[model samples]
Target: MAGVRKGGDLEEVEIDLGDASDPEDLDEGEQPETLWKASSDREGESIHSSSLVDISDTKPLINVRDPRGMNDCLKVTFEDVIAEPVSVRSGDRVWIWSHALFEVSRIWVYRIVTVLLAIPMSILSGILFAVLSCIHIWMISPCIKCILIGTRWLQKLWDVVLEVIVRPLLTSAGRCCGGFNIHLAEE
Candidate 1:
């Protein structure tokens, strides 16, 4: 039993699990009965009872056996590919035959294609990735690092040249030009 407050009023909810304390005590195909009851704080209010759903009574529409999830991409069925509204469904026998044919043909075609191409493509892709990784790690990365080190030395030399030579020359030029003045006239 649990108490819940709703809109300033306290409501009580009760869960009843009948008879069996341990789930293992129930026989195969037997489900423990579960009931939910809700009652308000107001006097003379009736308790509302609701029954819990039994999961064993329901079954999945599609049963896919993909242990490693490898066949997830191929789990589409005839019903998934084709569907009609409930009011416009095809005849029962025709739909059943179509489902059987589609599933059988799809499975066989996938097996045949994989047998022909899977191994060769996997080997080719593996070799290609290995070569690309080696080139990037051994050749391109080292070359880029060498270039970066050389640029750092060149940058220091450039800064020294700018400060020692260019700065003095620009300062002398500015001093020489400081004394000269030109007048602008309109003709």
Candidate 2:
């Protein structure tokens, strides 16, 4: 039993699971014994029962193998067991049949994704690539080439300036300090 407060009123909900009833039977006016009942705090008020989501008739998203029930394991036989054609069950409770179902689902997903998402994504990528290529060809490439040429010319000018100005200044300073060698042995 779980209780919740709604608008200052306490409501109690009890889950009935003794009958193990299928949820699909609720729509046919045969309410399953296993249900959730909600009672309000007010007296003489009837219990409110909301139908649980019924998924018994629908196929499950995942494959589950029943160990004790039918289709438990694969049987290896030397002779034919049944002459009648096997009916494919909607829900794959069998482990071996699950592989085929998975492959079928994969194929559908691939087709849908290719149709819905992949085509649009590819078109967007193509448009972006074309725009970038146009920018690179018209604007970016010329700017890059001009920057490279300017950088090379500036480097050459810097080397020439350093040789003309700094080397002569250092040589003149050495001469003015009364020669390049000041030996302790001579002193």
Candidate 3:
């Protein structure tokens, strides 16, 4: 069972590949039967078989060329992007050929552009990141550390000045004014 999305709607397609595992069960020169049945989700629609491709050979139906899965951006093909609902299908071979041309041109253009730009852009990015890292680690970080150490020393000096000079002066002033009293008499 495979789900194919056509124009933002997912339509279910049932694929019948009879007896894939036991090839010896069939007699010589007998090929496995492959059936593609379209089961649409729309109401009152009948199931129909469309021969999309011949997959009688032992090769995989979908060949993934990207072994490392790097080029995920290029995974969108003609079938993925272009599709017609059952009602609006034009049944024109020219449209199909145009679609094939569009897909091939898109893929080739992207590959060529990437081949031209990927290496240079990657090198530039690597150099930029390396420079930024060096500036942060060697220059900015050490400067900040030095400023913090100087700030700690200045804080200790400020605390000592407050305790020694300010506190003594305030205490002496308070002691001198301690005995002063005012009395009011009315005749």
Worst 10 residues of 1 by lDDT: 53-62
Which run of 10 residues does model 2 get worst, by summed lDDT?
Answer: 76-85
* lDDT of each candidate versus the true structure: 0.74, 0.64, 0.75
* Candidate 1 local lDDT, 35-143, one digit each (tens): 4345565664544434343332222323434556886786687878988898898898988988899889999998999999999999999999999999999999999
Give the winner by lDDT: 2 or 3: 3
**Superposition error at 9 for model 1 (Å):** 70
| Backbone N/Cα/C clashes per model | 0, 0, 0
| Pairs of colliding residues, candidate 3 | none
Instruction: Give the Å shift of residue 92 in candidate 1.
Output: 0.8
List where candidate 3 sits over 4 angstroms from the true fold.
1-74, 147-187
Can you write out model 3's per-residue Cα lDDT over 30-127, one digit (the tens) per residue?
A: 86554445657465354443444545553443564566779888678777888889788775897789797988899899899999999999999999
